[model samples]
Target chain A: MAEILARTVEVTRKYGDVTALDQVSLDIRAGEVVGLLGPNGAGKSTLVNLFAGLRKPTSGRVELLGGSPTDPARRRGIGVTPQETGLPPTLRVGECADFVAAHFPDPVGRGELLDRFGLGDLAKRQIGGLSGGQKRRLAVALAFIGRPRLVFLDEPTTGLDVEARRTLWDGIRRFHAEGGTVVLTSHYLEEIEALAERVVVIGGGRVLTDDTMDAVRGLVGIRRVTLTASGLPELTGVLGVEQEGTRTHLLTADSDALVRELVLSGAPFADLEIRPTSLEEAFLTITGRESQAA
Target chain B: MSLVLTHARYQFLETVRVPIAVIGSAFFPAMAMLFFVVPFAGDNAVASTYATGSMVIFAVMSACLFTYGIGVAEDRAQPWDPYLRTLPAGPVPRFTGRIITVMGLTLIAIIPVLVIAAVLTEATVTVPQLLLGLGAILVGSLPFTLMGLSIGYTFSSKAAIVIAQVVFFPTAVGGGLLTGDPAYAPEFIKIVSPYLPTRGAVELVWAATTDFTPNPLALIMLAVWVVVFAALAVWAYRRDEGRRFT
Candidate 1:
């Protein structure tokens, strides 16, 4: 069996009245690229931060390299690129790489690291002078400086252009080819579809689904329910809810139970529309026996 | 050692590349020496020597406060800061490295002030006393360094800048840096100066270079400030970490 690189056991993180991550457990074994898929405020970053040892769980254990998440020694085999980092504006690109490289026992050479990230040309330029894409590339490149066994990238390509995003995909592929484990979070499902073999989907601080990339896509056939309601009521059997202006788009696989419960709640309401057409396509695709459900 | 030097080296390169930063910290003490002490005190050996001591204290204070206080706050806002904090080495290597860089820059920063004092004034000190004065300047600077740490950790970049200024000016004026002679110190300052660390800091500098006798109360207050600020710095660090990451 492959060794586990990092995992959280029944982890729940709370920030005062808000529970960011519910009782969530995840295991990342070596040589696997696991994509954490979630929308905004979905506890994806919280779990990633736990695995990276940046935060402690309120009621559970987070382990890295079979040791305490807080222990610095456990970080020897790990690397992380947070969602945003302001590089020292004055340091040269090469110098920034070298400064981080100095912390490791056997670091990749500065020149080679720059080459690996396609940052060779910008090596001598100060970080303040680099463009946004270049800065993002550099931030991601620093994670691989120590040849870490596992890397956690939080929204690594949120702002990169298509070409730059592809370039980064190539870099990630090369690392995976060398037998490195990667766990990354992203809002873009296409990014996950392109890069991940396995995936974890989070919503409302809970792991809604965890499976292989193909399996995860095949896991749910959700009906998008749109409703005009004055306020949110206690929800039951609803997958998730998205609020925009005066309308709410609700996602669920079971709409009959959801609609019954919504009507029973006795809240002030108006125009109500339930989307079963999209679900018909998904439900058919999942059942394997083709039917003209749409 | 190499790790520490590596951090220090980059920090040095970063600061020096911005000429304004060097000019900004180095200018005030030298200007004070030029405008405040050169004409009035240059004719007398005792007066000029003590004045130079006060200015030296001023230079060290500026370096430590801005370098650690504002520098740490600025770094706190950076992605690189959290990345470094997460490394297996913890924060010791980087912290030591930054401190070393600050010490080095502080040394280089005061050279202009010392040069002006040497050429334009009759500030005379034996080689041993000068070395001791330099040593005392660094030692007495600990409280201000801690104060800067607290301020940096407690505030954002813009807020840090404002808070540092608000702390810097009053402490300088209240502690006796702007006033050349302690004997000629104003009444309000005389009462409150002994309670401020800067007053204690300048006294130690003066004592190191001249026949000045520092008040026992000033030294005690310096110690109190050091302990309090040190605690506050650590608290601010923990508070930042808890609020942002954990």
Candidate 2:
């Protein structure tokens, strides 16, 4: 059992009559990458702010490293990349990283962190001159410069191109592999699916689901299965099924059972394939409908 | 302590980068003193008095208004406020840092301003009185600094600028900048002027040249205003904190 790096208990924040975050509680363990998936205004930013100690919860408690988030010692072990682009525009990329590094007692070498993030060439360039994706990359590099045990990244790859996004995704996976815990909130479900081991879906200031990536996908059921067969066996218990000529395509949670039943039915099949449900389908199933109504 | 020093160093460096602040603090006062030398060269009384008084008052205004007002406003404009709050040092160290920077800048500017004022305007003052005036000017500026901070926190940039202008110029004029004779002013003006920051500064400056003494009640009133503005600033900060997380 890994130690919990961050935890929240019934934390609620209200702005006058409006509740930005309702009684929300979550636990993120060490060396784990938890993806926070939600639409805009799903209280994801609010939760990140709470964990960062940028704002105190109106009710309940939040703990980072088993202490108040405001504790300097606790904060030293935590890194954050906010949703808003926070690097000073006038500062150079290296200067911005140095400024954040100064906050920690011991920080990783500037050259090493910059090189890891593919920002070594742009180190001396002013932040104002960088493209949006470059700035975001710089922000991520700064967040990791401290070598913090836990990191909170909110929309970390918002402005990145496809290639840059993949590069960041690889960096995040490597960070998690190195035993650093990361809690990330992003609109890119594919990115989350690629990097995060667990997905925590939030909507309207509430957690819709928190489970492993495979479990979350299972909740939405497998999308499609293609098999060439003379006659399709009955799939009454299966979720959805379709047949065309000698080919049968079925959507079911139990693809193995369906395949076995087809084999037992003595159907001639040339190609057999089962496509697992993606994180996008699961996210849509959980949050898409409610967000549309809201 | 290191955190406070670091913040103060950054703040002071930032202020020095501003051309307006540099001109207003160091240049304007020196220019004002130059006028005293030309217009009242023969009369030592007016020239000496105006030289020391105007220079000191200007220095105080620069620290209180430019340093605290503009500095606080810019800090609020940045993500620094939230960033600082999240840090272990918290707002207290950051606020203390700004005050330390303001005081240091004010002290450093005073030396050159007074030296230039004395040399150009042939201003003369006793060593004891000069030291006393320095203490008085620093203390008197507190209320205005607090007021600037209150305005900085309570209002947006446009509103704060308008209010600062509306209050600063009129108060500077009516509080004995153009005229040394407080008795010559209207009764209501005299009563109101005494409580203004300009009046405290002028009185402190006047105390350096002649045998004039500051009104104890007026100083008390200024102190009361400082307390009030400080309270208001604290309240505004708390309200802003509540809004941020909420």
Candidate 3:
């Protein structure tokens, strides 16, 4: 197994009466892309903060690179781009990059970093003059400036357009391709699909599932079985049911088994259609189940 | 040392890029010289020389207080500061760099007053005396710098602005900076000046530039203020860090 770069051992964090993370344990190893997927307030940012040494866990331990997260020497091995940031608006892009670079022992060259993020031409411009998308690209690009072993990005592409988001992703991918570890949080499932090999689903400050991408997709393998039928008896293995006039839609995990049962029941169905559910609907199904269970 | 210098250069560049920041620090003291010293005491060698010393201290006080107090508070409110804090290098280098930048701006701020005195007023000093006075001004500005840092770390930028203003004017007036000579100062000021840090700071400036003897009580009080403000500044810093990060 790759060396464990960062770990939280049954960590819990709270803000007064609100619990941000609840007895959560996770390990980030070298040379892997881990995606933290959740809704708005599901402790993703809290976990990132703990690992980055920005905040301490209320209970339990957080270790980064085999030492305390708050130690400066240990923190030198990791880079982080918070969900929101404000760079010095008056400084030129190259100047801001150089200022941050001087703090590291070995930093990426400003020119190479700018070009990698597709921001080569904006080097001379003041940050105040850049568009919001351009500024966000710069913010994410700064995380790679120190050539850190591990990078934590909290919603790295929150306010970016499609083209800009892709540019940012390419920069991140180049780093990971060079054997760097990445842990990113995003509500955009497509982003996780495009980038992460491993996914951790978080809800209500607890880890719901942690598995490989294919496994997660297979686990929530919900299919929409729609048919034009009426006066049918209750169906087996249907997780959810919806109706639109003469058509009935049944959400089922095993479409093959549901179809066989329907045929055996002799429901006299016509125009039978079975389509795979999009990842978005499947994710909603999981979270919806979680909320109902809670 | 190189890292500290780099931080100082960037911080200085960041401040100077906004022309108004430097201009604001230079404006009040220069204006005070023009209105108070040049017209009224320009012909009197002794009066103009003493007023020039007071205005130089005034410039240093303004530069240290506003730059450290308001500048630091404003920086705290920004995301850039927290990001910088997360870096491996400790806060010492950045803190030293910011102080150096403020000292540079303070030197720049005193220039207009010196120029106005040299050209229009009868203020004069030998080369060694002038250098000594410059050194004294930097040393004397420490108390105000610490005071500024305390307010900065303890309050938001909005509140720091009002607090700095409230703290500045009385110290300037009550310390006898407005009076042309300490002997000619109001009776109330004479009694109160020894306790204000500004009095000791200006007295050191006067002693450096002229044959005047600084009051021992004022110098002792100045040292006390430095210690007091230093303690307060450190407490404020740790309090802020605990509340925000821990």
Candidate 4:
């Protein structure tokens, strides 16, 4: 098992009357890409902020590199790119990179870092004149400049185009391939699927599920069976049912059992199709159940 | 030390690239020299010398207040500030960096006033007097710097700008910067002037450059203001840090 690089032990953080995180505990291990999948206002950013030392837990504790997150020495081993950031408008891209790099003990070369993010050609451009996507890429690139063992990126590719997002993902992948640990939060399920080996789903300031990608898939394991039918009797093994005009759709964890029941019931149906549901449907199911329970 | 310089260099670059920000602090003092001093007191060696000292203080006060106060507040308003705070260098390097940047800008701001005094007015000083006057300007700027830092850390950028402006004119007037010398100004100003930090600042410059006697009361008050403002600045900074980052 990999060593734990960062951890939040029963951490609870509040902003006056609102609780951003409630007894949320998580561990990020070395050389693993962990995805924090949550909807907006679900304490994803708050968790990242605590680990990055930008905020303190109202209770419990946050540790980074085996020490208190607030300590400067421990902070040096980690890097973070927040959801929103503004660079010095008048500064050139190269200068901005240098400024952040100077804070770290061993920083990556400026040109190499820029090239990794596809920003090599923009070294001389002032941040104010760069396109929004370009500025975002630069901001994310700076996080890697420090050569940190652990990196936390909160919504790293928000507001970026598909091409720009891919470029950023490649950069992140390269870092992970080099044995770097990463914890990134994103609502984009595909982003999590593409990068994360471990998945931690959060909702309503609580962890709905924490498991490997394959294990989480098995947990949801829902399959959608659609057919054109009328007045169909309710079937066993069905978790949910939806009617669209003459077509009926059934959601079930066991598609084989549901199919067997459907055939035995002698339901008059046509165009019968059964397929595995996407992760989107599973996430909705998990989060929806959480909200209802709360 | 290198970290401090790196932070200072970048911060200086950030501000100097915007030419208007540089010109804003120097405008009023240079204009005052032109409109009031050059036309009226330009020929009187003693009066012109005293007026020059007051305007230099005026320049220093504005530069310190606006540069540190509004600049810091505006930086806090940006997402970049929070990001920078998260870095591992702690606050000392950044704070020292900002002070260095402000000192450089302050020197730039006083140039226009100095040029006007040297060229159009009868303001004369030996080399030693000039050097001492420069040292006095640096010393005089301390209280304003602390006051500006307090306002900056305590308020948002919008409120900070208004507060700095509101504080600017009253100190200039009450300290007798615009009245040539407090002893010759209205009786009310004479009584109040010694208590203003600006009065102590200008008096130091006057004593440094001319035969004028420095007021013991004004100097004492200046020291008091520095201590008080230092405490307030620290409180404001700690309060802001606790509220935002814990």
| Best candidate, TM-score | 4
Q: Mark the regions of model 3 whose C-alpha exceeds 4 Å error after superposition.
A: A82-85, A218-294, B242-246
| Candidate 3 residue-wise lDDT, A95-189, digit = tens | 98898888788999999989988889999998888887778888887888888999988778888999888878887888899899999888777
lDDT of 4 by residue, A115-211 (tens): 9889999999988998878888888888888889998887788789999888889888988999999998887777888899999988767788999
Collision pairs in model 1: A85-B79, A86-B79
Per-residue CA lDDT of candidate 2, range A1-294, in tens?
889888899999877787878889999899899999876777888888888877788899999999988667788888877334555665677766766676778899889999988889998887778988888888777678778899888778887888898899889888888888999888777677787899888877888889998986566565567877666656654654567777777766677887778778776677887887554544444564456555
A189 in model 1: Cα distance from truth in Å? 1.3
Candidate 2 local lDDT, B1-246, one digit each (tens): 777777776666556656577556666556655564435542565545654675567666756775566656666766646655654456666776777777777776677667765666556678887787777777767777777787777666667777777767776766655454454557766777777767766776676665777777666666777788789878876666635333
Q: Candidate 4: which stretches are off by over 4 Å? A: A82-85, A159-164, A218-285, A291-294, B242-246
Clash pairs detected, candidate 3: none
The candidate that achieves the highest DockQ relative to the unseen native structure: 1
Better of 3 and 4 by DockQ: 4
Candidate order by TM-score, decreasing, is: 4, 3, 1, 2
Q: What is the TM-score of chain A alone in each candidate?
A: 0.77, 0.76, 0.82, 0.82
- The TM-score obtained by model 3 is 0.86
lDDT of 1 by residue, B1-246 (tens): 887788779888988999898888888888888988898998888888878888888888888888788888987877667677677776557666777777777778789888988899888888888898888877788888888888888898888888888888889888877777889878988998999999888888888888888899999998899899889978887677635653
DockQ of 2: 0.23
- True-contact fraction in model 2 equals 0.28
Tens digit per residue, CA lDDT, model 3, B1-246: 888998999999999999998999999999999999999999988888899999998888888888898888998888777777667776678877988888899999999999999999888988998999999999899999999999999998999999999999999989989888888989999999999999999999899999999999999999999999999988897667624532
Runs of candidate 1 with Cα error greater than 4 angstroms are A82-85, A220-294, B184-191, B213-217
